[model samples]
Target: MKKAVGIDLGGTYIKAGLVDENGKIIKKQQFPTLAEKNDREIVLTQIEKSIEFAFEDNIEGIGVGTPGVVDDEGIVYEAPNLPCWDKINLKKIFEEKFKKKVVVENDVNTIAWGEYLFGAGKGSKTMICITLGTGLGGGIVKDGKLLRGGKYSAVEIGHIPIDYKGPKCKCGNIGCIERFVGRDYIVERAIKGIREGKKTKIYELVNGDLDKITPKTISDAYNLGDEFAESIWIDVGICLGAMFSGLVNLLNPDTIIIGGGISQAGKILFDTIEKTIKERAMKILSRDLKVVPAGLGIDAGIVSAGALIFQE
Candidate 1:
């Protein structure tokens, strides 16, 4: 059985695993990113160590899921999360260091591919994987192939403009859906509500420490029937669904798999998203589309990365 090594490089940690063609992770290891070291060489070394630990031997290739724009040649153009990585040639470094074939792709793309091949989208011919977290990232797969547009950055649904003059996005755009529905936006709205003395359970949950308020905290507050938090999630769902409506019209995918930290909100998130999409999307386009949550969870990156090398 041929095996592959998969690495998901993030700002805070590096997760690597040995995975088989069946999407089964045989071995796994993790380590801190140590990005502040300010040297790409050091970061690459740590990554190699994690890969080595995960795969003792017999790895056909290594696949890396990075947090930024990556060219088909496996070069990272920019990684906002990891400031140390800027236009780094990740594929060359890994291949030279380990003498193994390497494949590098954007982290969200990896996750989307993983889901399409082995998770919720296993049997779908066309699918869109949208991850809602710190920022919204997406990948679109058409007929089992990942779509890389002109700049190898297609399906960047998060940046799709919803409002012409809304809030500013980190991408320097105005009214991008990401600015309104991203994890930070969700938490920010909740914190604002609390600060305004909205009599809600969120105040009790965070104990006045607004800094500790996270998307998860807001989700928990929503589950506890906090009206303000619930409203925030509803708005997030509506925004996401509205964005997806355009995708539904364009691709008419069999599934749209929603993933990432905020997805853990479960029905509170999905219900609203589904409702909004149904109300907004074209009837024919949405009739058969399934909007589902991702199954791979945190392992999505590693599994998807491995698929880059292992999938037929």
Candidate 2:
């Protein structure tokens, strides 16, 4: 069986794996990103070593999923999460180090591609995969192909403006969907509610440590029958559903796959989101549109990264 290397370049860690064509990870390894060091050469060297370790032998090509705007030629224009990745020729570096054909794609796009080929959106012609975590990220597959815009930075659903004058986004936009539904936003809202002395179990859940407030913490509290946490998820689901409605009207895709840590909220989140969509979206577009959770889990990134090379 042919083998490929997939690398998920994250801010805190670099996850690399050797995967076969069937989406099975033959071997996997991880290393700290050490991005704060701000040494591009050192970072690249470390990545190269990690890939080499994962490769071992018989690796045909390499696919990298990075958290940034990657050009078609595999240059990283900018990575907001990693400060040293601006305008870095990641493709050139990897290719030079490994002497193998290398393809670089946006991390979110990688996930979408993975799902379209091996996960929830498999066999769908048009699909949108939304990942709800620390920040909202998305990948759109149209006609079973990744949509690369003029600048190769397409499918940025998170930045879609839901409000023109709402909260300022990290992307310099106002009222972006991410600003409303991302993990930070959820925690911020929860903290604000607690400060207002809203009666809820979140206070005790975090043991009075506001700093410990996280999306998971909120979800856990909600699972334990905390009204405050439950309300936060309800609001999150509503916002996500509202955003998805617009997408459904525009793309009319067969599936909208939701992934990431928060997706574990499961039925509570899905039911609320579906209810909002039913009430807000056009019935014509919403009909037959399936909103489902990603089946790949954390392995999605790794599998998707490898699929990049295998598919080529």
lDDT of 1 by residue, 64-154 (tens): 9898888767778768878889888889988888888888888898898899888998889899998888889999888878888776555
Candidate 2 per-residue lDDT over residues 148-225, each given as its tens digit? 778676688999998888989989889999999888888999999999999878888889999998888888888898
Off by over 4 Å in 1: none
Model 2 earns a TM-score of 0.96
Each candidate: RMSD: 1.5, 1.4
**Model 2 ranges off by over 4 Å:** none
Model 1, residue 78: what's the lDDT?
66
Q: Give the C-alpha miss distance for residue 302 in model 2, angstroms.
A: 1.4
Give lDDT per model, in order. 0.86, 0.87
